[model samples]
Target: MDGADYLHPGSEWAKEPDDIDSIDFSPTVTIMYFADDDTWQAVWGGREQLGEFEGTREEAIAWARERCNTIRIYSPSEGDIVDLVPDE
Candidate 1:
């Protein structure tokens, strides 16, 4: 896929109260995508973990665009790293 095909949406992820407790915030959105060779993966997550996805790079990008403020594209070899931190 062409790099230009990648699209990112703003404010796709937001800090919201949990369903169990409206006063508590524990929700987030995460999206993961794999490279063309399947050897690499890109994962994107929100402040919590409300939404999550794991698949090809295309799928991850699509998922993030649909449910994340920013899509972090990286290789699976990078390990599980925190791309962003929540603000208090």
Candidate 2:
């Protein structure tokens, strides 16, 4: 396999695949608030338990940035989700 294969599976022999960044999927990081626990949960890879945090969203973002490329904060009260990763 060629070096390009690592980036796009089989681009060396087959058609080059679409960019992974353009693919629409679930977020890599999520900051969720629990009313019962009154704590913020930093979820990684949609399922992996990264651990929990306390205080403002800024703190959570800082914590998540160290581990993930894209981060999302979900507000249960507002019932909305915010994406922290900027557009490329």
Candidate 3:
């Protein structure tokens, strides 16, 4: 498989990569929208608490996307979405 295969949705690498067994994909930032506070907070890895933003969900995702490859965005009423933003 090619390098791009690693990023493909149904590619072998994306499925179950066997090449780098020791690699670790961790510390993915998570963005959550709080309706009470009317703010979007970017939490790092666990609950380290990165920063709060006064913008839309897309902006929060873009912010988290800039810091890490994987992101978990949560919405108050719409549930949550996990995204694996590929590195360019």
| Regions more than 4 Å wrong, model 1 | 1-45, 75-88
lDDT of 3: 0.55
Kindly indicate the candidate among 1 and 2 with the higher lDDT. Answer: 2
Give the candidate number with the greatest lDDT: 2
| Worst-scoring 10-residue span by lDDT in model 2 | 2-11
Error of 3 at 70 (Å): 0.8
lDDT of 1 by residue, 1-88 (tens): 6322233322222223356453423333333333465532333333444545556656655655666554444324543323433330
Ranking by TM-score: 2, 3, 1
Estimated TM-score for each candidate:
0.36, 0.48, 0.47
lDDT of each: 0.42, 0.58, 0.55
RMSD to the hidden true structure, all candidates: 12.3, 13.4, 10.8
lDDT of 2 by residue, 36-66 (tens): 5566667676434545566666777788887
Kindly provide the TM-score of model 3 when superposed on the true structure, using C-alpha atoms. Answer: 0.47
**Clash pairs (backbone) in predicted model 3:** none
